[model samples]
Target: MGFAERFPRWTSAVLAIIQLALTAVIIGLEIKSIFIDLAHGTIWVGFWASLIFIKTLVMMLFITCCCRGRCCATYVLAWNIFSGILACVTIYFDRTFINDPCKCYLGDKLCCAVRSVDSFRTNYTSILDQCGQAIANNDKTALQWCSTGSPPYDKVQYLKAQLGCAVGMLISCALYVVIYIFACLGICFGHD
Candidate 1:
């Protein structure tokens, strides 16, 4: 017997669980990004994240249902196709969104503005000092998580999270591809 014949139930459960975990991580990262964006008065970033988060939540439900019953083969195939398309679109848009420079400031004083050619999106923020003054712009000032000895709130962390989400999405796409292939095979062979 082939892999599918030996352990069909086990395979379905494992794939569902893995996809669920990846989606959960994607959700957590997006939530963090939302909080960060809200703190900075940026709406679009959080809005996109919210959309993706909701979609992932729906995917989680489908996967859960798939794990519980035999009525899920067709649904799973459709969900996988939708997820793959969404993931591709998300990755493309994320690349476009993060390609701008972020202007970091504390009030009217420009604390630090990223160089105009950074490879990430704009995450304009204001980090105030204890005196309610903005930190001076310097080579060490970073917006996300930075190794440049910059203050907290470096935009690098946000960019990294976006990349992580894209990776998870790609993995999910691959999983769905495998699932749909088997689903088609089952249908053609009259196994279902």
Candidate 2:
């Protein structure tokens, strides 16, 4: 009689897929940060999220093709609980990255006034070259510019996206647990 009892079976699969996609997005964003040398707190988040994602994929395959009955439901419930806990932990780490300002540097020399991803990509080499020249010549104005810069658009956006995806995965896992509980109960009561 509960909402989960009436929920479509396909919905569980859909939720699992959503969680998988979200985790992948978080991982991809983290990889992007790593490539740009902006990865700080994201490293942990990415590592854990990747593990959860892979296990979820395997679980989904097992459940879809092989799992059956209340035992399978119990297993699913347990997995969801585990994944939910991981998502919570990742979210906590993700918050630290989101709250911190973006730090972009070339061998300890910070880029100046670079605000957007487009600006970073288009002018990074030039900025590096200019900073190097300024350093060699001890150009105070250029050096000051190199030292003072805003957060990069790409990093900020990636962190925000990762946070959002982590939250989504958490919600999906909780939903899966609820659905599996009702499924197990329904099986027990011969209402399945």
Candidate 3:
């Protein structure tokens, strides 16, 4: 069957086009984050490497959006929004995690800390449990128990900064998913 026959009408195809455009935008933003070739001086965020984990997933969802299904496109859109928010949150957390003076640098800007793969690995490993405990309660107290330097602002503020991007991604993804399904059921399936 032709593409239109599978879904009827050209609306699915049209939606697919819009989704594709959005996917392109997301990918472009991701790339821009990584490389700024201009001599204008790239302001590198100290802990950017940690953001790779979230961005990789986003890239996958970007690829998925190139599909032919209207439903699939919608799924991808939803996925993209969710993943984007998630990515942002994860990246934010990563940045904060990296910037933590006690945990990360261990020295002045000019000063070097234990500078080795093994040392880095150990640092991250130590904090894994802390992150988990924080997640268990979704509250800052649990996070503080894990440890952040200074006082009042340390735990909750830091956690909020980290989780905020993640929460944003979650909200966007959820809305996109719901919209796609609703559109498919109502418009594509003829219920609407």
Candidate 4:
């Protein structure tokens, strides 16, 4: 095949691979966040959505590699559209959820942060004194786990990584859309 004929297939394959890798990174981050109790509802949503998107990308890659002619153009276009929407939603969810103000715990026993001090007090009375003392003294190490203004250091890093990967996924999706548009046009003009 000529360069023009093979360009779309190569681009589609490369974009799908990149997106799959980014989605896997997001899933890994979500799983780690769950262990630290940093995974919010939106994180869970993003996790599930990433899983679905991974499957979709795999299928699209297979179709793009194996299918010839214009028969699969409509299917690929539809998948690309869905992937673009999913990536956008993931970006929004990650941005809003991570930036929201919430307490993050960094103690030996408590690694999760809650929104309400009263709720935290009621839930973990055993560590209340320690947390209170740390808060009162403003001990940097101890306060790291008891502060209420922002997320813990680890959680912040995790959120940043997830957000970065989400943005990468969005970029890949956009590239896929562009490549598919050219592919569709090629087919319409009997170039494929």
Candidate 5:
């Protein structure tokens, strides 16, 4: 009897839980990026939106596998391998996507800057209002102030989020491949 033959039943269940968690996190990050992209009128809205959908679908499949237990090991392994590959591709695309607040309307500049301020995470509306007044008054320094703020703009935060998700997804992908290999061995050796 080898590792697969002695593979405990709880491992699969634990993996399912982990898969659920990774999928959920990825979905949340993608949705957040999508919102920011939409507000900034980014050309990549469709791509990010699709990522949310894909993560949601992957979560659903993970739940199904969890409910079915070890009996569906082969199928689960296949699904995870595919999902892992998809996540890798998603990460690559996310890392390559351009993030720039200047691309949005001028009115959005202040909001973008305020949103990037980690301390003012919730007071974005007020900051935007104040910035809007300056813009309306034709304040020449307003653009300079907003653009050169300590936090810069929301694009920076959005890029951080994308990078975080991509790193997490990449780890999940490696874990999935490892689990899939174990499952393959277990099945081939007729381990229960």
Candidate 6:
């Protein structure tokens, strides 16, 4: 059986849709930062936007891989593994440390200011108090983790390089071409 026979064409279409949808959900996670954290400064806004765009492009890469099939399937798997690790790091930091703020995946991977409070969206009094503590106290421990180099936070960047980021990016670029070719020529190339 060929690639399509090994996996039904419908499977690819379904997976592409599912992956794209999940990517949207991941992007939504950043919305909290956009409204609440990014507004705190233009610097933060620029940072987060860049990370968001990067993630969006990665999703687009995965979708293209599904559509073309076989080629770069290994690379797609590796890309996803790296992505999952980052997601885990995000969850760990969000739950445990105040300094290890949730990193934006797509656009900039920039740090969103972390106040020692809970709810991201709301007029909670705790948020202001946390901000006051962050500002007035000049907590060095908090500051240390606040940098992207801190625990859990540094893991995402570390994995990307080890995975041969340049080769992965090249695969992404190839997938983009495959997508464009099909868009213009209609599966003629993808089939054989």
Question: What residue runs in model 5 are displaced by over 4 Å at the alpha carbon?
Answer: 1-7, 39-71, 98-152, 186-192
Q: Which residue ranges in model 3 land beyond 4 Å of their true spot?
A: 1-158
Q: Rank the candidates by TM-score, best first.
A: 4, 2, 1, 5, 6, 3
* Top lDDT hit: 2
lDDT tens string, model 4, 100-175?
A: 5243333433433332334454665545666677667766676444344345345556666787887787677777
For candidate 5, write residues 1-192 as lDDT tens digits: 444344444555555556556556655655565454343323343255345435534543554544434445455556556665666666555555544443444354543443433335677676676678777886656644534553225454665665565566556556655765776677677776
Q: What is the lDDT of candidate 4?
A: 0.62
Cα-based lDDT at residue 39, candidate 2: 24
Error at 10, model 2, angstroms: 1.8
Q: How close is candidate 3 to the true structure, as a TM-score?
A: 0.33
- lDDT (C-alpha, whole model) for all candidates: 0.47, 0.64, 0.40, 0.62, 0.52, 0.40
Q: Please give the range of 10 consecutive residues that has the lowest summed lDDT in model 6.
A: 39-48
lDDT tens readout by residue for model 1, 14-111: 55566566556655655665444332212234345445545544654555544433345445556566665666665655454355323232332322
Superposed by TM-score, candidate 2 places the C-alpha of residue 60 at a distance from the truth, in angstroms, of 2.0
Instruction: Mark the regions of model 1 whose C-alpha exceeds 4 Å error after superposition.
Output: 1-7, 39-71, 101-153, 186-192
TM-score of each: 0.51, 0.65, 0.33, 0.66, 0.50, 0.38
What's the alpha carbon RMSD for model 6? Answer: 11.2
lDDT of 2 at 145: 55
List runs of model 2 lying over 4 Å from the truth: 1-9, 38-41, 102-153, 190-192
| Per-residue lDDT of model 3, residues 35-115, tens digit only | 321101112221242244234344334434455556446445554564555456555644454354233322221112222
**RMSD to true structure for each model, in Å:** 9.1, 6.1, 12.8, 7.6, 7.4, 11.2
